[model samples]
Structure formats: C-alpha cells, structure tokens
Target: MAATLNEIYNARSIALIGASQDPNKAGYQVLKLLLDEGYEGKVYPVHPKEPEILGRKCYPSILDIPDAVDVMVVAVSAKVVINVMKQAEQRGDVKGAVVLSAGFAETGVPELVEAEAELVRIAKRAGIRVFGPNCIGMAYPALKLNTGFAPGIKLIEGSAAYVSQSGAFGGALLMFAGDQPCPQGFAKFGHIGNMCDVSNLELIEAFNNDPSVSVTGAYMEAVKDGRELMRIAAASEKPNLILKVGRSSLGAAAAMSHTGSLAGSDKVYDGAFKQCGIVRMDTVEDMTDGMKAVASLPKPKGNRVCVLTEAGGMGIVSMDTIDKTDLVLASIAGDTLAKLEETLPSMAMICKPDGYIDMTAAVSPEQQAESLRLVLADPGVDAVLLMGLPPIFRDAKDTAERISPVAKEFDKPVAVCFMRGESMAEGRRHFEENGIMTFDTPERAVKALETLYRAAFRNGHPLEDLPPAPRHHLVEKAVAQGRNLLEPEAVSLLADNGIPTVDHAFATSSEEAQDAAERFGGPVVLKVVSPDVIHKSDAGGVKVNIRSRSEMADAYDAMMSEVASRVPGADIHGAMIVPLAEPGTEIIIGMVRDPQFGPTIMFGLGGIFVEVFKDVSFRVAPFNEEVALDMIKETKAFELLGGVRGETARDVGSLVDLLVKVSRMAATQPEISEIDLNPVRIYERGLAVLDARIILSCGN
Candidate 1:
C-alpha cells in the first residue's frame, strides 16, 4: 500500500532541504511561497551553510530539526536525493518527501534510474510516501499549503482537486482561476511526476474522499494500474473529469492484434472511463470548464433543458447548441405555458415544444427572472440554459442577483450565458459568486449542462455488478492447441457460451464436405480453416452458395488448390462447411485486449462498412444488458437495426443478449485475447454469427 494523501497534503511541519537565501534558486522560491501563501504550519528550512533563511531558523539536517517532520521538500542535486531520503529514514519522523529535482529517470540514464529506484526502495522500507524525484510537488489552498516553486499562483480556496502527470501543467492550473473566466477554485493540487512511488490513483482516491472536494480533475498521460483505477473510479460516485493525452495512430502502431489495430488503446481508455463513470475531456480547457460547472451546480435529474434568452436570435442559437448535445429542449407543460402567458408581456412568444421561450429585449430583468422560475417549475425541465442577459433594463449585477436565488430554490442546474462584453464582466462574476455557473457563449453553457446531465445519468444508472460468466470448455480445449482458433472452433466457443451461430462443421476432405452440404439440403458455404488467413476471400479460400453436392465437392477442391496457390506453406486445417446465412443487417462484435483496461468490447456495422464508415461503439467488459443496449445504441448505424426504409425492426433484445454473453465470455476467459464475430446476420427473428475468429493468448 502507498502512503495516504493526508500525510502529503495536510503535513503540519514541512522541512525544505538545501534552503537558500538566493532569490534565483528554487529552494528560496519554494520556502518564500510557503511563507507568502500563509501555510498554517511550522516551517523548518534545512541548509548546512545558512544559519537562517527566509527569516526562519535553518537546520543542517533532518536530525537537527529537533522535531518530527511531516514532509521533506528537497530541492538539492539529484545525486544527493538518495542521501536526503537516507536522512529522512534516519530520523524516521518524515512521513512524506517531495523531491523537486529533474535528473532522475526522466534523463534516461541508468545511474539516475537506479538512483530513483533506490529512493523509492528506501522510502518504502521507511513507510515514507514519496511524491517525485522530478516534480513541482503539491499545493492545497484550503489547508493554506503551497509546496510548489511557482510564483504568483493565486491559491484561491474551492472544491475542485486537480491531479496532473505534467508538473508544469499542474502548476498552471493553480493559476487558472486568475486567468480563466471560471469561478471554481482548487481545494488541493498534486504533480506526481515519474510516479516512481506514489501514483495518480492514490491522489484521486484521496481527493474524492475529501469532504471539501466536490469535483476531481486529472491530467494523465497514462495510467499505472488500469484495473485498480477502474475499480476505484467505478466505486466512487463523485464526478471525475480526466484529460488523457497521447491519443494518436503512431502510438497505436505498437499493437499486434486486429482489435488493437481497429481501435487504439485510447478507445480502451474511453470505454473504461465511461464504465467507471468518469467524464473524459478532450482538452485542458474542457476539463477545467467542466470542473467549474460540476463544482458549482447541482446534478441535473435529466437531459431536458429549458432555454431562456432575452434576444430571439440568442434563443435560437441556444436551441441549436443544445440539439447537438445529449441534452434535449424540454417540452413546456401546458400549465406552465399558461402561467407564462399570464405573467409575461403580451409580446412574449413562449413555445415550450420548440425548446426556448424568447422573452425579447423589451422584457424587464424581473420579468425574465419570473419567466425562468415559471419554466423551471415544470416537471419536464431538468435544467435551464439562460442567455443574453444585458444591462439595458438593469445593471448586469442586479440582474444576476435577481436570477441567482432561483437556482437554489429549484435545486437544479442553472447556467447563465451572458453575451461577452466589458459591461457583462461584472454580471458574470456576480452570477458565479452567487453560486450560479456562467459561460461566455451559449454553446459553452450547453456543454456545461451536458456534463452535469451525464454525471446525473451515471449516478442514476450505475452499472450492475454482473455475476461472473460460466466457463466454456470448448474454448479451453482450443487454447490447449497453442494457436489461434479456427473458424469452426471459434463458432464452437460461442455456441458453448449460449451464443447463436450458423450450423457449421469442419470437413477434412471433399467427400465429407459433400455429405455436409447434402445434410444442409440448401445453399452451403465452404471456407478454408486457416488461423493464419484473417481474410479468406483475399486468399481465394471461400466458396459460398453451393446448392448441390457436386458443386460442393468441386468448390471444395478448387478452394484448396486456390488457397495453396495464393498462400504458400500455409497451415491449412481443412475447411468449414456451413449453411449460407439469409440476407439481413450485418453487424460486428469483438473484444480486444488493451495493454491497459484489460478486454474492451466493440460493436459496429459489419462487412465493408465496418472499415469504410468506421461507425462503432465501445464499452468495458463484464457489463450487464443495460450497458450492452447502450453500446449498441451509441453507434451511428443503430437506425438500421431499428428498421430503416419501412423494414421490420431486428430482434434488438436478442442482440443485446448476445452482446452481454460475449462480454461475459471475454471477462471469464483470460487466455482468449481477442474475439471477432463479423457480418453477424441480424433478422426480424434472431441473429446468426456468419464468421468467428478467436485469438488465444500465448500464455496458454
């Protein structure tokens, strides 16, 4: 177990090693900030030469402190970092150490790697938690702690706790409150560089557990332990916003499997984050913007939003932005509309169904407030996006004051989008200061509202703790063969798991293939069984619609000869003789082993569309039917499954069942690294797996 964050963030007595009087040095800067930021704790500056620094008595070493040190902030040479830990171990009172030097593992030197490793080993033996050998350390405004070396970081006290892998970015976020238009502030901040000892997961767990932290934001390049992080995030109901970097095809080229090739590890991260109820942000600005909304407002009960704008054009823009998100314009109730009709000016054109109630510029601020309250009272309105507040009737601050109390009264999210102007700056601040989230644009307001709604949706529809999947003996037997499974074997694996598959049998000779075709009594398909051939058609190893026994016999011989000619020295394992599947919507379902996040399931349109359109959705494995249904619904091709062009809807419930079972199989069988069932025929009655490919792990 790692050291708890309480020891690192709430340390009572911090010792700054190599403390200096020179203002240019990092030691002087850190010590000065600690004092300047009003850290309400004892500070002991340790330096061998200096008797006193930063107007505080200096000690030569950790042993000379004459008191237990809760934290040791080291800003000395990397070569001496180990000695500092040794001193910390000798004193045995230092519970945590934050090293602010860069010449460790990041330098790619063997000696630095060994030195960093030694630092962790010593700290582990001493039961001392370590932050970094190359980091800016941490800061907590609520506790009045500023251990980082950055200057002029306005450490305002609020509820969002930020954790970052990049030390500079972490320090930058501490200054975001002063730079950005957001009103949210940090409760705690940490920069776990190198992560040689303590990890981002531990800090997130601590911050989520903190009563003062209402939102947790993380900037992570990679996760240390994917499973543990997933478990922790899944268990926590708090809103977590993460901005993950390194999402690119260049990084994805390292994958050796088809599933990995199709969707990179980034997609795996996406699925796992969603499974654990963590909101993923695309950029740093989005993460900070989202955190501000999450910290300030209540979680929305639903996605239905009521748009209230002073200008007609702004109301339309708000509706357009909301339409692009998961949020929907709420249907105004008749009674609410009648109430608005009676209360508003005669010119007020309120159309709840169309999504916005335009109060026009002629209305007073009081009228706008009253109109908003009336709309919020409707049961259909889960939240409201108010925009176009101007200083024509009343000052921006006065308007903000009148509308701010309405959010608390309704107990739902109320986001205001004041048109950007110098005059509206005070209005925005007043709205934010009074506990209402404010945005500069309508689209931003909708984005914030969407975040709040997603949080609420996840909280309401938490993932079910599914029972473990039963074993599939056929899969185990195939794995014992020490190679990827043949198509027939893959089909058998699915069959054993209660997944419906086309009638199929492996025939070693043309006579057997003929007999199998006769038994089918209709159109049959002959596919060469070669684990090496991912695409049989490309190698001339597949013959479909063989209606007669003689045709089956002839096609079998031709396929073998063509495959032998096309792919020389291939390990041909006979051929699969199966009945031809009926025409229906084709779908693909597969699971890929991500280096992180374990097995991630993917569903999308099958056949050429799978590659051409790339319409797909993903989710982590071991999910119940509800999640499976959602995974299917998220795809752009879902409308086809729902019966487009006046066609009958396919058995979506059955498909969901298949998805759930596949998830179970992937979760239960560790040796099975990948499962691809492409071109699955989805009909009005049921579904059939036309082709299957299961890749086994080398471990078996």
Candidate 2:
C-alpha cells in the first residue's frame, strides 16, 4: 500500500471541494496559496456556482469532473461535510482527503460527533485515507504544496518536519518561523485536529522512512497512542524532539500501593522519553532552538565539553550551566594549556576548574579564533561552547566572521552563546547562516550541546524495541478470583515468576499453625490470610519471631482476637506461617497499569517508609536485562545496594534477574492490574520476597 500521507502530500492532481473566488473565506486563501506557490500537481477548483476561479476551470462537484483526482481537499462547513464526502466516495478515484473543515468532534456536540464517525466509515469504505476533520491541514515546502490555509507565509526549504496537536498555535508558530530574517526552514508541517484520522504517530512513521526528513519535532498537548509512539521513536534513524505539555496536571493512579501514589503520569512520560531516546523540549522557544541545533550541528563525540568565552562573567555562567547537564567539563590537556598561556594576554584565566578559558573583553577576534582552534583540537574535549558579550570597543560581526570558519573546521559540535541582544544580531546571523548553532543565553546554548551528545550516544548504542510477551500462567486464576490477594497466593505469584519466597505454609486452626511452624525448625512469622485486610500490619494481622509451637499457637489466637476487635465484622481467614527471612538491604519492586502509557514498573527504597521517602524511579515495561539494570541505577537505592560505608555488596545480580522477570510478567499479563513487592530483602548472595501484594483488574 502507498504511504497515506505521501499520497496526500505528493498527489498528482487535487480537487479543491470548496474552492472560492471570495478573498475573505479560507477556501479562497488555500487555493490562492497553492496556485501562487506553484504546486507541481494539477489543481481542479470545485465550487457550487462559479465557472472559473483563479484562472482555473471550476467544477460543480467531483463526480462531474471528467478526469481522475488523486486527492480531494475538503474546505466545506461541517453541516454538509457528510454529503460532500458521500458524493466524493461515489467517484471512487480519490486516494486521500485533506478534511480541513471544522465543527466536528472538537465542539463536544453529539450530532457533529456522529457525523464525524459516519465520515470516517465512508472514507474507509472507499479506501480513502483521511487527514483531519478539524485541522488547518499540512504544508510540504520541499514539494511546493500548500494544502493548508495558513496565509502570507512562505516556508523556506529545510530538512526538519513538525507536527502539532493544537491547530492555531501550530500555524502561528510556523508563520512566525517563516517570517524570520534567517528562518529555520522545515520540510513538512501538519496539524492533528481532533485526531479523527491521521495523527502525529502516522506522520512520524512516514517521516522515519522518508530520506528528505533529517529530524522531526512536534508540539503535543497529549498522545492517544503512546505505545506506538514509543516504538516509532526508539527505532527512528534520526533525532526526535517533542514539546509535551500537561506537566501542571501531574497526578498518580488512585490504586492500592506506593507504586500508584508515586508514579505520576508526567514523570512516567519523562521516563518513556528517555527510554525511547527522544529529546524533550519544554517550550515553543525550546522547540525552535532545539530543532535548529540538531539539524545544523554534528553530534558531539562524547559528553566532555569545553567552554571558551571572551568575557569573565559569560565564562562563569557557561561553566555553571554545564555542571547541571550530562555534559561534563573536559580536562584540558597539558599541551593545550601551555599553548593557551603563551598565546593569550596576561588578563586571561586558563583552566581554573578544567576545560574553561576566560579571555577578558580586551581580546581581539584573532585571539578568540586561535583559542577555539586549540581547545577543539584537545583529545579531552568532545565539544565546545563559545560565549561572548561584545564591549563597545570590540566588533561583534568581525568576531563572528573570524570564529565561524574556525568552528566549522573541526568535526566536533559547536554551540555559541552571543549575548548583548540586538547589538549582536549581525554576529548571530553570521553564525546561523554558516551552520553553527547560536543562542542568546548560556543555558540555552549548553542545552543544545547536551542534545547533540545524547543523540549521538543513543545512535551508537540503540535500545531493543521489545514486543509484548505471551501471557504469564499465573495471571489466569488471579483475575477470576480477584481482590487484595491473600499472602500465600501473592507469594505464589512471585515464586511462579522465577522469584524466591521464604518457606511458607497455610494453616486454618491454632494446632495447624503450630504444626506448620515446627516443620520450619526455626523462628517463623505468622501473617493473616484475608482479602479484607489490605494492610496486614496496620490491622494487627501480623505477628513475628515465634520460637516454639506453644508461642505460635498463642500468637495466632491473640492476633485473631486483636484483628477482630480492630476491624469490626472483617472476615477472619487463617494464617500463613513462614520462616523468618534474613535481614538485608530492603527495596521495593512494583508494577501498575498506567492509564495512558500502560504497565510501568517501579524500583525504590522499601520497608514501611516506601511511601514517606518516595525516592523512586519508573520504566515503561517490556524491556531487556540491560534496561532493567538502567532502572535500578536510576534510583538512589543503587548506591546502598552496591554497599555503603564499608558494607558488603548485596546480590545485585539476583535483584536484576527479579526485575527482568517482573517486567515480563507486567508486560504480558493484562489481568494483574497492580503489584506491590515491598521490602524484598537483598542478602549478600541472594534475595527474598518478604511480602507481596497484587491487586487484580476485576472481582468487585
């Protein structure tokens, strides 16, 4: 099958459904822009009454046209959109439809929503792919096609593509981009209006294969299909940038464990981005700045960065910002430091902390170029960030002309922060036109360098796009009989998934409890087995350290009475008696079905304070052993697990194996909705699941 977007964007002939001669209407603007921009494809204007529009023959309807149309541009009102589509579907030759009409599902009206659904059914029946029912449409600058009504702007040709969920904001940004003195050009621009049909995922999928697109960026308020997006982004050959909103609406799932309360949706999205190797931008400014930087510069060879500045204050600010990012200051080599000392004036400071140099405001443009050349040549430096605040005596444009050529000579990435605002416009423009990433602030420039390093690292070491595994066997019976699972059952679930649980047995009566304890031949713990008691300790349902059979029986009787008094009318089930587990570093491993992203696994410090000190990390599931290790390293508990203050290293290998198994179970089993394995003690050579709680999907 043909690429749906390719058919629409590169159509041989187009039928403009609501083309008009009136200047005020969007119909007129869309047609005029297409014709004026010199779209190579044939245009057939379709209007109700006009015989001719914009010097082209106008048709009453698509059916009346004699020739076949490759694409249909629908610019009609929502009231008659169904009728227009019905008529076009009869033609059967239209391959794609750009439905630029409004008044569909976005209005929250029942009638329009029904009409939108009907429109989708009609298009699919005729084998026609739909773009949008409430969008401004798309623009392909490289192909000279204007299927959108964004007016008065002509986008220059470049290798970047942008997709937006908000139509008005998207078009305005594109328009502003096209109007700049040295605008960042784009290959394609699309707006997903209501996402009735095609979305950012489809567009990104199409762009991933297209050779003309080098980088892709989007302005998304939300995503409907995060799984597909994650898959596409991880496998992408080029860099992907996203400005995802909804940060202020951060909230966690209202489920039954620390996993649900700590794994906020926004933080999960952050983890997903990192997992898929995507560059996340925070604002429109970031989107534009990031796109330009990635499209223009070669990625850094490594994370080590060197900062060169002509002013002391700018150098200080640049070094401070670099410390906050993954990019580290390079340790300038001895040869390079000696060269800098001999070449610079006495006012210059050389490598105070590391890979930073401050040549005072009095340095000439020639000296600036020489310093950049020497720093970039150092084997320790992977990239260079140059900053300058031109004084009244120094010429900004002259400095740009001198440094731009030298910056380009090295294959390493270069990000320049040229301050003093409009006074340095000439210098900034010089750098931009010469293909150097330039920013107005030191922080922004460092961020660009960081993007380069991250992209390069991911490309060299790509992650596996693991698919969902077969359903785990334990999930079958758990869903059928669901609730806060009993201790024996929950522990069985973990053991079945290749995890080790302490030796345990279930007993209904006091004599049975004593017999079960004696079989262990050591101290044991007794925990009540009742679905009603969600937190056993809080409900007085737990008693530990029973050395004798008499002590076990007495403990069991007293616990039952205490639980009955605390939780009135609670169903009193029997007790699970298990041998006492050896103490070690306690950690939590959890799985919760995220409403949007699905099956996010978490790891953190555990044992009672799991909720209080929420030092946790999350990863969307279906990952491999390497990624599982990444999840563990992301938390502060990693240091403790490795041993702190001369303590022996716990069994990190055993914990990693457990995490991988839990991840597999989470990915394949849809019925096991949430799981909490709190205080899974990690011993020197092995680990044990001390307690487990799994909440099933249904069983109300």
Candidate 3:
C-alpha cells in the first residue's frame, strides 16, 4: 500500500506500455493528457511497433529503456500486461504499475481472472505495487499529475480525498468536481480495480493521516477489509463521508456482478457505519453536501440548532428537517431575545424558528447582519440556520460577507439557504467563498448543519467502557456439549452471568410440570423447550400466566400438543415451568456481529414492536456506561422508559448497565455468534430477562 501511494504520487519518470502515435487511441490520449495536465515527470513510450512516437524516442520494451522508470502504466491487452510488467520489474527503479487493461475477473472469464491474479503475484514478488487491471487510473491535482487515458481537467485541490472501486465512477466524480461550484479542497480520486492488494481501507488510512487532507469521502461497492476500515474510521478525528452503493437487494446483485464484490445486508452496513461514526449518505449530491458542510461549518458545540429565517414557510421547513435528524430546536435564551428586541420591532416573535424578523422592511446589509448576530448569540443555540431571500436584500453579496464575519465572531456555525433562483447565485458564491456554508434549499442547509452537529458532538462523546458481563453457566455447558442454547438453557446461562431471569424448573412430564408449578407458587408460566424450536411463541410452544397447578398441567399438555401440531416434525425437549414474571416495560437487548465493525449491541422497545416499529439504537461492542446510556436515550422508546403518561419510569440505569455488560460479553467471546434477550422486563426496581437465546459459532 505504501508502494502504491508513493508510486502514484512520485512518479518522476513513467513508462506507458502499448503507447501509440494514433491521436484517437486511448494510449495516445493518455500520453497527451500527461503533457497537457503539466505533469513534470518524464515519459517513456514502450511500443514494439514504433521506433519514434509523439515526438519522443519510443522503446521496443521496458527492458530496452535506458533510464529506469518510476512508474509503469500498462495499457496493453490483458494477456500482455504480465509480460509488460515482467519487463518493467527488470528495471531497478520501476516502483509501481497501473494496469489500465480490462478483461479481468469482472468479466467472469476464468483465463483472464488467472492472468490478472498472476499480474498481482508478479508485482508482489517484484516488490512493486499494482493499481488496477480494469480502472480509470489516478490523478493528483496539486502535483499536476494525470496517469490514465481519462480527460485532462483541473482537479480541485483542498482537503477531501475520494476513492472508488469503479473506474468510470471515479472519473465521473473527478469530472463532477471540476464542474460543480464547490469549496476549494485537495482531492485524490482513484479507482481500485481488482484490488488484489491495495484496498479502500488503505487509501482511507492514508488520507486520514495526510496533513493536507481534512476530510475523506469514498464511493465503495464493497469493503475489502471491513474491520480495518472500521477501525481506521473510528479512530480518525477527521470527518468521513461514505456513499456505499448497492444497498438494495437488486443493487447488491448488480454490484456483485459489476465488481465481484459482496455487498452485504443493508442492516449490517447501517450498524457498521453507526459504530464507526462514518456519515453514510444515500447519493452523490448528499456526499458533496456533507463534505461542504464539514469543510465550511464550524464544529458545533452540540446537536441543538436554532433557525432564524425571514420567511415563515422556510423556517417551518427547516424545523421539519431538524426534527427528521437528531438536532433539537433549542428554546431562545433571554439574553438573545433581549438583543433581538432592541434591533427589531415590538411585535416580533423571538422563538426557536425566529422568522418574525421583517426582512422586507430591512433592505440594508447591517440589518441582516444584526438579525443573524442576535440569533447566533443565543446561549441555547449551538448552530444557526439563516434563510436568505436574495430579492429582498439590496446588497445580497455584501450581506453575506457581512454576516460571515459576525458569525465567526460569535464562534457559531451559520449556514445560509438562498431561497431565490439563479439570481442569488452570486450571493451564494460569495458566502461559500467567505467560508460560510450556503445551500440552495433550506432542507439541504438543514441537512448539512445536522451532519456538522453530529460530527462535532460525536467527537467529544466517545463510546464508554463496558462493565463485566455475567458468566453464563448453561452457555459453558452447551459449549462442552456442542449445542445451541434454547430458552431454558439461555435463561440459566443469563442467571449464571448475573443477569436476573424468572425462576424456572425443567419438567419431563405433565405430572412433573404440576409438581414444579406447585413448588414455584402462584401465576406460573409453562413453555415447551425444544432444540428445534427457537421461536417458541411463534410455534405455539409457550403458555404464559397459569394461576394454579391444574392450569399448569393443562397448559403443559396443550403447549406440547400445539407445538407438535405447528412444527409437525419438531422434537420437544420437555416443558419449562417458571414463575410468571410481573408485567413491566419490555425492552430488547441483543448483539449482532457486524461484518465491518465486529460485535455491535442493539437496544430498542422489546416485544412484537421490536420488529414492527423497528425503533432501535446500536453501538459497537465493549461500550462503557456512558455510551450505553446514550444509546438508550437515543431511542424513541426512551420516553416510555421515562414514565410516559401515568406509568412510572423503569430503572433505565439498570438497563444501561445490562447493555454495557452484554456488549463486553460480545467483545470478549468471539464464539458467541448472537445473543437475543427479548422482553427484558424493566421494573422500577430492576430488570429481568424473560427469555433469552445464545447461538454459538458452529465451530465452537
């Protein structure tokens, strides 16, 4: 990977294999681009057919070139790439090779795949890095370098560096960057074709460590080393904007065929991105929006945003957008209101969406700047959104420039939304040029502000360290027996681990069930335990709240009969007679091993709503109490836990502790495949696991 980056950056002398004199050929275009783009490097065209091409002495082969080349760009056929590479490797100074040839594994051609693999192996042996077998190559704008056949265009030089797997996509992004009116930033856009060695993770890590780069963006089809990427993203302080294509099933299949990638489940990607703190965007526009926001906006103190707009409708829209995100609309502080009162009319309403400021009456830049300054000074406002009407302000550009310095003075992120059409383009450009984030629409501005707030706040509040998990007795026994834990076994394991479970006893027969129910006391619960039936409730294998021994005996028989009827071929492992747990707030605590982020803990409203409502929050495993508490509070069900209506708030602290413990367990035990503790009853005093299941790795 070091070799790859160096080869791309410091290629003082390059050998272009299959170089042609014909102007229309890709080889000719590549050489022309290098010269046109002001690449200071020397060029050696390797062509067996021509003695001289493009006003330069052409070598028959790389071996024949008198001078050693720093990098080799192979544009020959796939079959000839290896041969060319072998010749290039013979040169002592040949450090890296970018194979622009196609017909690799992407075509699903067996022979070509082998040829590509051989190219990788030869390059590896030669200690030379390979870029792509089917790629658009790379460009370094700051250095004025262009290596592939892609067109020569002015690449934006700033902080954001972009990497993609698709050559066409990378080229398109470069072209878009050149065309779009974006903030100045250094960008390293490249394609990772047939990533045999160099991968997305390596590039991200490089950019993250690079002093020139302040932010990183990626358009990845699939992660080659997901764990490595997650680790890098999680540890890096720079904001990362990732747009992962092929999120849907159809798109995943298409991506698989296009790049030979495994675009895993969307849920897994969501969990992984959340855990790593990587801002995931759905489209290219969103990616740019996020990047611009990060580049221009100041780090917000918190997620609370205060909107001060001239148009009430735009303010309402901004409020709606804020509600959609994690950002809260802060109440106006008294000092802020007082400041605004002196500047504005008596009838002005200075609330959260403080749009009562008369923009029509104030045509002066000073008035607009004063309005903005007053809003930003509010102690409760962490960030401010200003919706500017270009037609109303006489000097829109002056107003934008004036507002920028005042916003900086207050040390707050002030985003401007130009409500007018192309007429406001000048004003928008002025604001953007002055480092004030300006968006075309209110929603876009709000989104950028929200992302800025999230990135800023996320930096300080790191995931907390988790508590020690309870030892699972049944899990240990099951590990010895080489079996998955059913509900009863899982419950016993939870009890062993220090997690409270409802008191239960295994019964082999109806008579035993009756006896166990008598011993357990009133309101017994009967559940038929079977190795084959993981979802007992769904299979009619569970019977809850049996008051008497007679009821228990009948329920045990009925549950067994029902389970047998429903499953038909399931082998019942007898019944579990337990004391019925008192009704309380039901919550779920589960662990899923995310492919990219490793183990992740999930918390949400438990019971059937866990699936139906899908109100869940996730954090990477090994989280501390603080992180666990944040995850719990982040959920919509937090209101319920805080005693909604007449209900008493459950012991949320206990739940957070339990989550931390579970996360630690997941992190420590690699063999534990999954942990599902549904309906973890949260009482005012404590919590109890009503049902649990632990699925261990098959190898374990």
Per-candidate clashes, comma-separated: 0, 0, 10
Candidate 2 overall lDDT versus native? 0.82
lDDT of 3 by residue, 360-476 (tens): 434356766887777677677788888867554365776677777887787788888876466676787777777787776888888888778766655323444444445456666
Give the clashing residue pairs of candidate 2, or none: none
Model 3 earns a TM-score of: 0.88
lDDT of 2 by residue, 153-268 (tens): 57678888888887777786677565443677888888878787788788877877788888888888888867777888888888888888886322433445678878877778
lDDT of each: 0.82, 0.82, 0.74
Scored by TM-score, the top model is 1
> Which regions of candidate 3 deviate over 4 angstroms?
1-7, 22-25, 51-54, 149-153, 180-183, 248-264, 304-313, 330-358, 376-381, 392-410, 419-422, 460-482
Report the C-alpha displacement of residue 298, candidate 1, in angstroms.
Answer: 2.4
Model 1 worst lDDT window (10 residues): 249-258
TM-score, every prediction: 0.94, 0.93, 0.88
The C-alpha local distance difference test score for the whole of candidate 3 amounts to: 0.74
Top-down TM-score ranking: 1, 2, 3
| Error of model 1, residue 593, in angstroms | 0.8
